[model samples]
Target: MSGIDNLPPLREVIATHDLAAKKSLGQNFLLDLNLTAKIARLAGDLSQSDVLEIGPGPGGLTRGLLAEGARRVLAIEKDPRCVPALAEIADAYPGQLQIINGDALDVNPLEHLTSPIKIAANLPYNVGTELLVRWLTPPAWPPFWESLTLMFQREVAQRIVAQPGGKAYGRLALLAQWRTDPRIVMELPPEAFSPPPKVSSAVVHLSALPAPRYPANPATLNRVVAAAFNQRRKMLRSALKSLDPAIEDHLHAAGIKPTERAEQVHLEAFCALARSLDS
Candidate 1:
């Protein structure tokens, strides 16, 4: 038992479906069953959780989620070509696997999914960061999903978990780290993907915090972080000049320096700056 319902091998499934990964779609199929299972495990016990999988190309990760006993798997794939391929898994798993053929950006999972859903996906490179942001900043706290287990290009993954004063630290880091504890759980070589990408990839698992690390209006923090990192080399006072004329006062109130660049500011300081603006 390859831990599934004796379905055809993923390679054969690709050949039968002629699922040639399209560059326009940012497709890179993870045909490795072992790795897929590992990703499922990293998401913790999915036995009682409904799993939301984005861009499940050929249902590689989808199968693993099901095999690991996810109560149900809602596999969202924009590419119509992969829908039928996913249907086969749906049949094998009975009612556990649900395939939705549409753009992930357009679908609001909150409106449909019940509480305690865990998201696990090998997201498309083009839209992964944007989707993660959308999930992280839903006007409401504790946005639906219990956790997120995702794969991204190694460099992109680093940015998501990067620390202050690092080259990769920027808006993504602040946004992700603010409300969740994120870290890279596994790394994948370029060769691990079908139609391997130029850069290596890694898996990031983020668990939501009951509340944000610090208190700041979400909109204000977003604007502040964007301005500060928009011209990362410039000092915060200068980079944020376009947003507010009294930027120095806000920085001083936050106990941050006018000469500090974006990367030098930590999450707490950014929250302070944002709060100061509203004060």
Candidate 2:
């Protein structure tokens, strides 16, 4: 679409500036401008919102977000080598773009912008899950961002959206489902990157709920899920022994079978177990 910004194609921007993907930084540059724009579109309404992007290796998706009319973009990049290249994009876009050179985990994005923020990123593989966990569990009641549109290895994406009774379903799925409606919006093969990753990648769109659907302590739920799924082969009674001696009684009170495996238990059941632990 003509609404697309005038930033040069990602490949030209990379070659002109000599930006190569650095493995140690967990960088894999997405060089397709069209694909980047598509990702921006799938992130939902951004006209009234500021966008926060983590690990924009060469500004491909960063440019796309600006083109799609994000009110403002606060992009955090860990790699200093690509700072000048992103600076060029900032020059082209004027006041709409702000680049911060720092680790995303350390930066408080909410401090930089007020509410109505959407975090969209082709997050580095190494830190993607950790970042999502932080956003999903921020201390505030309603989170700062309106939504999260993030890229991850397809396997990780599956785990995020996985249903109960599946191999991919576990702690990640429980935490995500506890707060948001998450789904897979797009898939990218290995060839989409400068140095293609061994695995395929997928974009996940997660819209936060007003609050968690089930009421339970986050700490107990995390511990229960971790232990239950860790020894998935064992029955819930045996698996939950590390938690409390009467976990089996709690399971029965929650209407869950004491013989059930973690994968067979649903989110509500997990919440029940967590609540039971508190009793």
Candidate 3:
């Protein structure tokens, strides 16, 4: 039995392993091999890329990646119950699959990959956002992964690709848009999962750019964006008061209108503002 044909259908695998979705772990296993395969394909040409997956409950998505002919797949699973099932995939693929049993947040994926990595997973809801932020802000230039294709609550996916003035636009949009091109590749309704979540889900694909769209210190930009969006309803003249008592000076320097609300300012303006604050 190989990674593709050896394992029972995901349903039987889940049943055999007694792997039910756990709310605390944000577990929502996608048993539809077709859907999982579709998600994997959205990563685009994985044959030469090392794929990193988080929360591979019962190895459903792991099987999909391996079958798709990824050069290698490194899956991190927190639930001990699913480890054996994932191990089964590892055993089937021999040198193709690596299973790490731990919270994904604590393990740095960069340590495991060489280069030209692509991350694909049906992420656990609770830790998804935190993991994205970590991937977004690595210690230096040229982050480990070339692209990220992961699942998120539909609303969160919208936020990642949202425009400046939309309700969903906030720190996430700014952070993601600043350094990468993020888009919603597909949508999955709640019923797609075994224990369906209350909210619908969507898959987001983010490909890293050669460099940030605007040149500003990431640390400064993060601080400025976080503070500005903290009270998005307020005008920049008011919301950015802490950045500088003379908000108009910063605004004028950044070429942004002082009357604009946090959500009204474009990413370029945010980077400009951060640069102004730096000086």
**What's the true lDDT of residue 91 in model 2?**
95
Q: Candidate 1's residue-wise lDDT over 2-65, tens digit each?
A: 5565888788889999999999999999988989989989999998888999999898899899
Model 3's alpha-carbon lDDT is 0.89
Task: Output the TM-score of candidate 2.
Answer: 0.97
In Å, residue 77's CA in model 2 sits off its true spot by: 0.4
| Candidate 2 lDDT by residue in tens digits, 1-279 | 223676677778779888888898888889888899999999987889999999998898998998888889999999987889899889988898899999998998877885688999999999999999998887765788889999999999999999987899988999899999999999999999889999999999999999898998888888999999899999999999979988889999888999999999999989988998898
TM-score of candidate 1 versus the correct structure, residues matched by position: 0.97
Worst 10 residues of 2 by lDDT: 1-10
Q: Say which prediction, candidate 1 or candidate 2, comes out ahead on lDDT.
A: 1
What TM-scores do the predictions have?
0.97, 0.97, 0.96
Which structure among the candidates has the greatest lDDT?
1
lDDT of 3 at 263: 86
Ranking by TM-score: 1, 2, 3
Assess each prediction's global lDDT (C-alpha) against the native. Answer: 0.91, 0.90, 0.89
Report the lDDT tens digits of candidate 3 across residue range 46-112.
Answer: 8999999999998878888888889999899899999988888888899999889998978887788
Off by over 4 Å in 1: 1-3
